[model samples]
Target: MAAKRKSNKKTRKKKKQLIPPAFIVGGIFFVMVLLIILAVINIKVKNLEKDIKLEQSKFNYARQIEKDIKAIFYDLEIDKSFAKHELIKENKKILLKYYLKLNKNEVDTLFYNIGNLLKKEKFKISYFSENELSAENEFIKIVFKVSRFKKSANKTNKEMYLKNKNNNHRLSIIIDDCGNNINLAKKLASIPYPITMSVIPFLKYSKETVKIAKQHNKTVFLHLPMQPKTYPNTDPGKGAIFLNTPKSLIEIIIRKDVEDLGFIEGANNHMGSALTENREKMQQVLNALKKYTDTFIDSHTSTKTVAYNVCKSLKMKCGMNRKFIDNVDDKNYIREKLYEVLSLFEKYNTIIIIGHLKENTIQVLKEELPHLQQKGIKITNIKEVLN
Candidate 1:
């Protein structure tokens, strides 16, 4: 019994010595390190969240600036030919250098209008002059230079130039989503304007609409469906290209779509808010387009789109949608959109406006096209756009 009791005491002592002091210290140190790592990861996660929010906010501000610029140009009646934009990237911010050609009166009007607009938008005017205007906010910076308007050297050229200034503005009206509605197509065909019809594949009357448009002397564009940002749920419909789709698969998809459209003169994205942002995917898409069609237009659904850059790199002639007309099905909204279209001519030597082939859209065009023609906006075909 005495031996057993001694053994129990020794066992207790052994149990107490089992964990060395160094081991205890090491365990505490390891726990502290783990906690520090966790804290750092938590902080990084929060920072990432803040970054995402900031990016979204910046995108919103950029869109607002685009609208403000559009409104300003329209109000000033500045010719698009005289206004140009050069993008500069620095420290993750895009600086836009606006080259403007304006008369003294327009310059005066610009300052008065822009000064008020910037102030309302919480921007500070960094610099102001008769020839230059600069403004900045947290997310945006604006600088525009007004150059002297060039005059024709000879009297004959000057006279001719004045006579055809409006005609020089090339406008292409692309009627999108055409295949589903043959009656609308029929109505559009009867219209005198050289309308360009962009038909989506796998629609009820895909080939039939193409035939109709061709018969009516209309230019056809393959309305290439693509994955929008809200994909999987939004579903860009049949024959749409997804970002995850392999390059080889994209080529096959595009080829089949092109062949299905039955000789498209040009192509444009149907709903490519997501796919246009992927540079590699866009390169593949544009290459496929280069095989069958000469021209492509970025649908401009997403501001982050690299489609235009990719298209230029591939040397494929391309354009982008300046604005979407008739997004709302209302006649008044469309009329307002068309009214805005008139002002675009002053800024763009060539631009294409996209609209759906709905009944209301057709009606609005028929009513407003005559007025546009009267005002010297030439309603030309898509081929003329690249020219």
Candidate 2:
């Protein structure tokens, strides 16, 4: 019986050892499976992140392409207007060349859209070419040469009509108060259009403004200061010719003003409300301007201006401002004023528009001047307008 009990205990011990080994093997298998599953999941997450990044990059590229297309469209609109006026009204041939760094599809789209726009505007396309260019680097070069057929009419009548029409319509723009800032004057002069720069005499930048105006082939005028209705409260600045200035003194001041402001083609009152209304005062100023061969422009500061009559009596070449562009210093308002000038152009066939060196005025001119040129409006100097 003692030996039977000992054998049973040994059997129990063996059973316990065998049970532990089985549990250990199962735990090791579970850990291996978990590690393999985690490795697989990590690889999938990495692939998903890369795909998201790629998709984001593609979206950004598409947005940039859209923006570029819109910009190209706007530029084409301006070019089309210019081409139409030159070809249809002026009977001139225009060759426009554009270089763009764009992909093949974008280039093709640009040409197609331009062609359609021009066709819609009744413009006959005389020449068109597009190809990949390698100057400096790879870019797309597009050339468009356009013209219009002249109407069949009696040659004599046609010549007479055209001659009269050309002679009648003229527009002059004068930018005043230019001597205060030389940099602004330089920027205004750099514009590739005929505009008159009326610099205030004896201002801080008066000489520098004239120098830059001449350098850029811009016409310069003396923005002579005269007393305004507001009087001392609205001072026109130093060297102003007031209403109370004596006739002799006025003549001396006028001549000195012209002499000091070298390279000026004409003189226009700066703020001559009171002086312009005083006939005698205005006559003295206009008479002085005659000796210098400098034309006079009545700024028309006062509705009761006698400067115009004085100029006529003195036989001085003169013009009057029909519109002031930046009275409100608002873009929309200035634009409306410009359109008013255009309307005046239709009726009078000649108009002079004056604007200050304000930022809004410059912005409007930079944007709309090209459009004005596109509409067959001539931007001329004060001399041409007066003639």
Candidate 1, 1-387: lDDT as tens digits: 999999999999999889888998999999999999999999999999998898777767776676667666764467889888764544665566789887643553454345445656777667644366677787778888878655346444324434446777767888888899888889988888888899999899999999998898898899999986544434677888998988899889988897787779888998776789889999988887888987998766665679988988888888887777654455765676666555556577887887888788889999988876775668887777863
**Model 2: worst 10 consecutive residues (lDDT sum):** 132-141
**Positional deviation of 321 in candidate 2, in angstroms?**
0.6
Clashing pairs in 2: none
The lDDT, on a scale of 0 to 1, for candidate 2 is 0.66
lDDT of 2 by residue, 152-221 (tens): 4544322433443454567889999899987788779878888899999888889899999998888888
For lDDT, the strongest prediction is 1
Q: Predicted candidate 1: what Cα RMSD to the true structure?
A: 15.4
Q: List the residue pairs that clash in candidate 1.
A: 79-346, 79-347, 80-346, 80-347, 80-348
Q: What are the lDDT scores of the predictions, listed in order?
A: 0.76, 0.66
RMSD of 2: 17.7
